[model samples]
Target: MSVRARGTLGRFLLTLLVALLALGMPLAPANADPTVGPAQDEPLPVTVNLTKITPTFADSSTPVHVEAELTNTGDETITELWIRLQRDQWISTRAQLQIVDDQQPPYAWAMSAPTSLSAPLDPGDSMSVTLTVSRDELVMYDAGAYPILLNVYGTVDGWENHVGQAAFTMPHADQRPDTPLGVSWVLPLIDQPRRVSGTDVFTDDTLATEISSGGRLENILDAAEEYGEQAKISLVVDPALIDALDAMSDGYQVRTDTGNIDGAGAEAAASFLTRLTDVADTSAIIATPYSDVDAVALVRAGMPEVLSDARTYGADIITDVLDTDPITNIAWPADGIMTDDTWQTLVADGVDTALLSGASYGQEDYLESPLGITESASTVLPNGRAIVADPGLSRLLTAAPQYAGGPVPAAQRITAELAMISLQMPTEARNVVLAPPRDWAPSEQLLDDLFTTTTNADWLTPMSLQQVSEGPPVDRGPLQYPATLSEQELPGNILESFAAPLQQVAELGSAFDPEDTDEALWPTRAALFDAASSAWRGGDGSAVSNGLDTANDALATLRAQIHIVTPSDGTYTLTSSDAPLVFTIENNLPWDVHYRIGIDESRSVGLTAEDVGVQTIPGGTRATVQLPTSVERSGAFTVVAQIRTPDGDPLGNDVQINVSSSAYGTAALWVTGIAFTALLALIARRWWRRHLFWAEERRKRADAQAHQLREDAGDHGQHEYRSDDAIVPPDFAGYDVPPRDEHR
Candidate 1:
């Protein structure tokens, strides 16, 4: 019963399973499938993802398409799903965006008609819906920025509205009337100094690698190449950057964390320079100061000398390195803010135009249409012109194409602004200068698109810096040169710390002036500017600090080379009371060092100097200077050897010579001889006294012996008469001894 019944059950079960599968009946439990359904308490929802279908529009007659993805993101399926498009024109200008409420911006209108979805969307399911409309449908014909929103709503679990939406923009009539908006683009070619802590010259290939490879500078070069001669672009290059690259082009040395390295960036640097020269042929090349000095800080520090030196050094370095002349009539200060002192300094340096920050002007009158006024980007000064960069346009130029609203939307915002300015003036064209941030990093696609839009917009016309600067100056009001904020203010101590080296450089340059050695003076100015670079920002300015330290060290080394050669203990002994002391002067500098060998008056107590004047020592050789010194008295004296310039400026380190006079040695010898003679005389007197006493005692002993012999002879004569009387002789012997003592 088990075998037959089992076979029949198996066959029957297999057949039933096949029939269920063929009829599309689920074989697994409904709860086991992860995508089955949502919780019973959850409400039905709809989501919208908008896609920018129409990137650009020529006029109001053009059509705009916007695509959206609708998804049922709830527990149940959404039936009769509908996607609606809402349009709002951004009433606020680009300048007002920072001040306006961005969370819920003020739109012109809201809530447009709804378009039904073709099919129902189930839970975790989605469908695409394309919404098409004309430029006039959205009322975007007045040439302005418009922000569009797409909302998806559907009927799920009774009634459910749009739970999710997507926002974008559709800029219409991004063009104007007959008048074209004049736009000039200012691109910066600046980088931080390569060697922050080393010698005077740049000792690294950072700029070379940046310009030759896929880097920020390379991107800029690519843009220039793409624009060619059509776009009226101006280049503001930092001479430090060019100088650094130039240094690298010839097998330079770089200081690293560990030590120094002989760099091999010459090929890379030459390649970059070749490309740069190509771009420079067409664009208006303007060179920044040698090290991009902080103009405001320099002014605040009251360092007009440094500013003056930096200006000429900057131009000279660029001219020498690049072998190309740059527009020296303009100065672009960092942060674009310049103080009155800075303005005067620039004017004194023959700078006719100053590119400054937009905050320098009062924009309250033209907030709505800032660019409508010709003076927005330009202010007429008594001596020259101050062109304030338009912040809005700069931001637009810097904005990446992949921004929130897509490339066209971003471009259209700027285009619409330009068009507004053009529309305001049907016959008059105003110049608008746009300067990108110092380190703008935008994609090539975005830059190309912007260039295309600007070129084809027809309402905007491109102008070069030459043309812009050459135009007639507009009459403007008082100049507002505001002080930098406390946060942005550079400390006086830091500037002072760097300025000391510059002073040294100036002194050294002056000392070398009469020699007609221009080449020697070249690096001194460059090194000074390097110490005062604006790139040294924040956190104690370690780089520039290191540079200052290095400059001081270099000068110290140079000074040490021409030092006085003295004894190991820094003391020299003189055999004579007064004589000519010869001090050896060593000149290790590559060039001849002309200095005066003099005695420091305060320390020269016992010594008088003669024939101490300026003397020229050949390079890489040591010369002896015979300094005539007269000693007042014989003692220990310090002969101070100081090296000074022909004009009395200290050139190097001071040297001190400890001199022991011969008079002191002679006095010591006389005292020693007198002490020795006195000691000999005392010894002789003691010897004579002891000898006389011994001789006297010897004479008395001899006389006593003679008396004893006489007594003995008499006692013998008495003993011959009476030998038996020897016993009685004891008292007699005592008496005889007493008599002999009396005789002695």
Candidate 2:
């Protein structure tokens, strides 16, 4: 080899050593520092997963994941080669990082995004590779070693050896791992913060009379104060009116839903609540500013631990309060809802569980809402179903939009806001305690005032919190919001235009909105995983054995979904069918589903054209269709059935029936065979005779008559034939009738 060629070979040898060292492959001729060319082989880079290493939490020796790129870096193609840890004692061969990056930050949430090689690398090439190495794993696996060694080998380049060195450290990826949190809030409409009992009333309805809304607010705020140490709150209200809240509660008198208190007039309900807050040792006045943090480097920022509970505070979304704290617990109050950025934030925080409450009380839907879960990856909220907000939360958020700064806010203002936001609330049997329609709450005078004055936004429609000319706080609470609502339900004359929020919270209740406020103002989330590991009852009992076999079969074949009998604490509901589709829903947690089935029918298209009876298979039985006798015994038939929820949704799809023909289904084979033979014989007999028997006899009789006619014929061309009796002589019975024909 030339001088340059020798150099290339030398470099190849060096890389070979590194590859072998990283892969932990044994070097041939153990005594030699560098092996010869014959054993040198090319090396292919492989990613090493560390999840299997199972770090004993906080063990420094346990590394998260170790990986390296070893291309032929030389002029050789790599084949199957041994790649293992440099020293078995330093790193485990079982390490795996099967989890993806987007799946989660460090919480129980599943990884949403996948990890992949940016591009293919070649010799004299480079590739950026990454792995999730748990700090504890590195510490545990390395023990006293500060750096971990990985080896890669290629037999062609055994002359060269090199090892990839990786440093050990773990980032605090997960912050609030205990729960996925959210804010619940209520908007006070009476414009006062006074706590009323069941009986108080302003006019005839509960707004003036009911105290549940106000009391719920205090309870929610207190809970947050206790649980939300790392949480920040966005309180929407007019800066000038916060003090008025106390006057509404000054009397400290017992509240009755039936009658209004004598002194609780509306000038400002502050003195009323001030006394109450003092009793609860409430600190609304002494409360600190809400907090915020950059999710990327949470640890370096000196941030407190994330809150582990759900908490909320009531806000008056009218202009004043929002002007000061535009981004309160509720982020974007647009079109009565918003869910824009809440999910992203929660995932970053490492939340595992999420709960969603309905917004409108009377307008609740039977189906669980998707809750904007479609926008977020499944890693954070597994399966994406959430609890609905209670009726209580709806009543509170309704008043904020209407209460914004107004010289004389009309009752219709409150009603309009109420109606728009009540679309998603829960129900209480027949009675739906929903927000009132636009004109429903206005007084006669207010109606007249609305028509005459167009100064404050169109009275016909409600304004979004974001549209109120106030920007949000640095760390605004996100509300579940929608980009827009269908205009079909709105009044065309109400306004020239209305633009809704760009995003909305999922049915689970959180969004990326600048003005979204929720009831209770504070909420948390959690995620837990449990496998059907014990599908086979460990104990040997009749129920256990039968149940296990059923479960095992169910898992093996997804013909049915395993539903846990709900509210039983620990239970399952196995709904099975040989059908292709199944659907259902369960809000209850801590459950896993599996199913089993056997075909009851032999075909997909069941054809009993003669009988139109509905097909019925026993519940829990698989599907089957009988093969048509008209079709050959060797023919096949398809069977189909769909599984669905009580409300009708496909579940465990891809199930089907494929029929194989056999003699077992043919009961009348012998009879059919005999009948078929007989029919064939009859057809053959008719074909062989040429159908001449009837014609031959008729032809013979005609010939006899014609013979008689010959005797009577005068002319062969025009003769009229006569019967033998007539053509022959009177005494000649068989003679021809030639004499009679002559006269004709």
Candidate 3:
């Protein structure tokens, strides 16, 4: 072979060999960490959950004790399970603490002796394990948060591997900082609205369970009662809830599918209210908008007045029910995000401060600071002050309780993060606000641990939300609401659903007398606010729809009470073409109603009915209205009668009336006169004819008498005929007249 061909052949063989090796090699998993444990695809034979960690903030003299639960979650049983505690170097910055999981922490500072499980752990079974690390074993530690891991080693299917691990941070303060971090916890006391709209009935009885023993609310109340004074906690209350509890305490009713039944939580409600009132004395009370209405959604839904009314009514309710003056200027949007329009609307509604999320400012660059210290929690806005909640702390507080370790691990991490912040800037004297979700349901243990951890930590000082708002301000650029946060808002479609009910409620209010408008419309207005609650965000809107339905039904029932009464015979008789059409309107409502009597004569020909001016009927009374009506001709025709509001909104059902007129029209009167005159002329002609006949008979009789006399004279001899002729005239009085058809 030629030299060039030999070189090409050798290169081709080498390239083929390289391709073959590349295909045989395994690809690494994306973003995989080998130091963590087994491969990502490997099923963990055991799961470790840290349930308790004593001395959350430890010192040189205090030893840290940890208690955990080891569960076999894999398909097969695991035997010879061992667990130990491993600690890494102290966390230097807040950023480091946040990304602790991703960091390759050597965790070689301290290691506790491994503890073994006595029996085999079957699938779906859990076992408790405790591991303690003495201060000496922990070695000399810096004053900061240290990343810790609970490592579980077990033999699964006769194979030993790192089965499971749980990571958390532990804080150690060798000496107290001169200026501790001011931690303000905003504990929410809000829930979904439970009362049915416009009635003293509840939609469900779940509220009864919520306020009872071991309930979510009960746990919150317990925390407040136990540690409210010990910690700087502020109770952010929803006035709608207080109003409901007050009503419940007074023996309210609950509506069921079958019907309304007596509620079972009167006593519990009373007790809760009493305790809450006591707690209010020690803790600062912050009133949320009535029902915790979504301000942004309300403004967008064209119901800005609802938000305003909610704010006003909420403060009043808190004062009335709890008998304590509550702070009302702070507006906390349910999702902690808002637009410029919403902010302006709130400000116009008398809000001077806002509780917002740190993410609202789009300060990710600053939030991911390396020194564990960002900007101040309080920021000065264009027209108001905003108390921004720490994103990291809020997430941990809201989401940690649901994890495997429950609130213990979360509480530990929060304590560590706070300590690291204070240690990084020991003299900065910064403040932080821990604002969880409005509907956060914290376990009893979570509350206890959080309160205990903050109280015992030397580098932390608990403060009230009010004090937090008064802290030094920082500049967090312009508001840049995240699209993800906007997605979490109560949707526009759901807010729009409330417009119909609100309009109906407004119409109902207008139907009543001016004095009764507020009393009549407040219930439905409050219900609409309930439907606009932030709690309905991310929901299917069924509850809101149900509440709206109830409001509509109540309005329908109210409107139905005022109606036009049908005549007994279902017919009206008119004595004349132009007469008054009388109708009886019955108002069954407890308040006076103003309505105009409207007559619909469209179905009748040559008939026009006048409109009766607005009439006010007293409660439980009947009023009669006379409408002037005119008809072109006398006949039977049908007209519809209905009552309407002054604004022309129809109320009640339309009534049909059959009218019959007996009076004659102008054309008929003229024809009757002509016929009468003709008949009179005929009678007079008949009388004259009778007179002429009598005269003619008289003349004929005379002529006949004269003729008879002459004949008698001519025939003197016949004396008897003359005597008969002389007597003929006299006999004519008694004699009948002879027929006069002779040619004479």
Q: Give the winner by TM-score.
A: 3
Q: What is the lDDT of every predicted structure here? A: 0.64, 0.27, 0.76
Cα TM-score per model: 0.68, 0.20, 0.77
The lDDT ranking, best first, is 3, 1, 2
The number of the candidate with the highest lDDT is: 3
Candidate 1 vs candidate 3: the lDDT winner is 3
Candidate 3: list runs displaced more than 4 Å: 1-49, 69-81, 101-110, 117-128, 154-165, 200-204, 246-266, 364-372, 491-508, 513-515, 539-554, 573-584, 601-613, 620-635, 660-744
Report the poorest 10 consecutive residues by lDDT, candidate 3.
Answer: 26-35
Model 1 over residues 139-195: C-alpha lDDT tens digits?
454555566556556666776544545555444554446677777878888887665
lDDT of 1: 0.64
Q: Please give the lDDT score at residue 508 for candidate 2.
A: 15
lDDT of 2: 0.27
Q: What ranking of all candidate models by TM-score puts the best one first?
A: 3, 1, 2
For candidate 3, lDDT tens digit of each residue in 1-744? 975576456545644553464355322222433223334566466667778897877887788888988888889888887777766655677767656645445455456567786888899999888888875455435677777767777777897656767667787776767898888888888989988755678888888888899778888889889888778678889998898999899898988888899999999999999999999989888899988988887887788988998898889889989999998778888767788788899999888888898678875323434333565688887798898888877876766556444567777777777776677678878888888787777788788888887776667888877787788888777777788767766767767877776777666666777779866666777877787888887777776777677666766776778999999999888888677788898988788888888776575554577766778899899988888877556778788887888777777888888888787555556667888998998999999999999989987897787877557545543323344434432233443455777513
Model 2 stretches astray by more than 4 angstroms: 1-603, 606-635, 660-693, 704-730, 733-744
Q: List the residue pairs that clash in candidate 3.
A: 94-372
